[model samples]
Target: MENLGVGKVLLVEDDERLAALIAHFLTQHGFEVRAVHRGDVALAAFLEFKPRVVVLDLMLPGQSGLHVCREIRAISDIPIVILTAKEDDLDHILGLESGADDYVIKPIKPPVLLARLRALQRRQVPQDSVRGALEFGRLVIDRSCREVRLGAQVIDLTTMEFELLWLLASAAGTLLSRDDILNRMRGIAFDGLNRSVDVYISKLRGKLNDNPREPVCIKTIWGKGYLFNPFAWEV
Candidate 1:
């Protein structure tokens, strides 16, 4: 983020007042915010702004927020928090199932929104950067070399694949959405499908002999996303 404490937010709400107020409050807290009223415009802003997160309203014009959410999930992994009207439970779960990392109801209080944003941010930073090595069974990730070793065999990986492995292994217990991986690692402008991530992750698992069913290391969070078992790193 260009700014420090406040993370960047791409706000997509038709209500001009709410968008401005939210942006102002978040900006005061050192967050970089960009407001877009239309879903299409919001998509454009998201790519250009490279926001760490996004605030989307389900009732957006030009394009429905649900559609936007699906489209965004197709490319980047930036965390997204959907804003929906009360009683819009269907849309809410759909948003999550569609790939949103979180959601907030309408009539949002600025303070609450800020708090939620912070909590999500806190979850992403690693708790043990100095650990040096991540060992999941016979598979080892040596941070110093930025390499993964399965027993005596070293598995070669692309830059993105290595990063994806690192991010998941480091998080351990946390669930990582595809959007979060793509956005943070590759930037929001990344143009690819979740399948790209799936393919890379699948390849890594195969090389490591990570069971696709009842995986011992990285596990798919079904309905939501993927999570790495830090306990899997216990040597």
Candidate 2:
């Protein structure tokens, strides 16, 4: 594979051999990769490198990958795909809760990892349908700038969160099932167990200032899916 020059990728892995191999593979597949072997310095490297995305390992020398993920997310919404060695459900949920955009369980398949990275990138790409800014009362969604503003305040959202919001808001009152959302956003069929959509929806609700207990804007349809009520955005 030749480098398509898609974007820069920051890889944080302790193992020298694995890091080198991952870097090489990503570089060949159109990414400029910078491999870092320490979690403590990952943030510094991220700030300096300003990569489009991050590939992080769970275990590190000093700082844990979860801590690194939280720190990175505090400043920027740069996409983070954590590499977790454990297949435990708690580990997976905790990684997402730590602000990681996605997680990959090792031993890693380079192609699968690459696909996940590309999916993250796709969320950042603007769509033709969202030509101009969308306004619902005080809420403003600007597709061109990929920004969402509530009243006078700017809401910070990860790439995935923003994409999910846009998809639902565009449909307004329509109910979007989990399978429907997965297919549209990820270009893949849902296996009925992928909770990425639900996780991101929670994150989006938090950022959007929607009440979790009595959510008015983005509401869950119980067994159906999710619904974005445009009218609920009003004061």
- By TM-score, the best candidate is 2
Q: State the weakest 10-residue window (summed lDDT) of model 2.
A: 1-10
* TM-score for candidate 2: 0.91
lDDT of 1 by residue, 1-235 (tens): 1322337788999999999999999999988998999987877887788877888998888998988987876776556788888545555557765666666777898888887687666544442443478877677887666568877888765434566788888787888887887666544422333354666667667666679777867888776678887666445
Per-model TM against the reference = 0.57, 0.91
Q: Model 2, 193-232: lDDT tens per residue?
A: 6777888888888888889888888999999999999998
The number of clashing residue pairs in each candidate reads: 6, 1
Q: Please give the RMSD to the true structure for each candidate, in Å.
A: 9.7, 3.7
Q: Rate the local accuracy (lDDT) of all candidates.
A: 0.73, 0.85
* Global local distance difference test of model 2: 0.85
